[model samples]
Target: METLEAADMTQLLMESHELSTMINQSREVSDYLSAKRQMEADVEAQRLLALFEKKKEQYEDVQRFGKYHPDYNHISKEVRELKRTIELLDSVQAFKRAEDSLDELLYQVSRTIANAVSGTIKVPSNNPFLEAQSSGCGTGGSCGCSVKKPS
Candidate 1:
């Protein structure tokens, strides 16, 4: 039984590696990489991204220590505006779309694998992955949906 389990694990790993390779070679991934490179090379985008990161860090720090800072609201607004502006860029928009596509692909693959392992598991027909992608509520937090616990 141990040897059989080992063989099954090895097979699963090999298949997972193949799937990863396929995902990497996909157009969405290629586009995402290209857009990322372009964004990195843009001076203005870099400046905006740096500013956003700095403000985000400050906000997180304030929240973490349970301190009320008068600048919190201002920082939050600035972050949102910066993000909106960044998203308006063609390269950034392309990167976002590619990222969402890749995310959905990965989520679907994971769900399929889980369902295969546990035949009793059933996912609703609403395409939760795509819904989450579109809603832009990644992983968790205020999505009005219960978070799934890992088994």
Candidate 2:
């Protein structure tokens, strides 16, 4: 009986030691998981911050120079080429006209404004063209509508 009791105590002690070791290992695993999660969150935050910075820079550039806007790329390119051509030209008036390049811009702006006035944003008054009963410059006056005058 004494030998059996000794053997039982030894077995219990071994089991207790194993249980404590498992508990310690579980704690370590928990710590490791927590660290990994925090690292992932930190990496995600940094990624978002970088994305925000890039977008902010683009926004600032667009605000500072209107040509940087996404919608202005093609028009801006055309304008730049036009300016270069005008610079090469020997005539000053031609250069001025190219530099102004106001026709297309004016048309687009006017069309957008007209659409807004007619649909989304209401204006106090209608456009003169809308009020006019006849088309084709009825008064025989220079009613500039998509005119491309040569300088």
Give the Cα lDDT of each candidate: 0.69, 0.46
RMSD of 2: 32.5
For model 2, how does the per-residue alpha-carbon lDDT over 71-102 read when each residue is reduced to its tens digit?
55654555455545434433433333433343
- The candidate 1 region of ten consecutive residues with least summed lDDT is 130-139
Candidate 1's TM-score reads 0.65
Clash number for each model: 0, 0
Cα lDDT over the full model 1? 0.69
Residue 114 in model 2: shift from native, Å? 55
TM-score, candidate 2, is: 0.19
Weakest 10 consecutive residues, lDDT, candidate 2?
A: 130-139
- Model 1, 1-151: lDDT tens per residue? 3553345888879998999999899877887788789878888888888888887887786666443677767767777888898778776777777777777676677667755666334433345654433333223557655434333
Flag regions of model 2 displaced more than 4 Å. 1-41, 66-68, 71-151
Candidate 1: residue 76 lDDT (0-100): 71
- TM-score per candidate: 0.65, 0.19
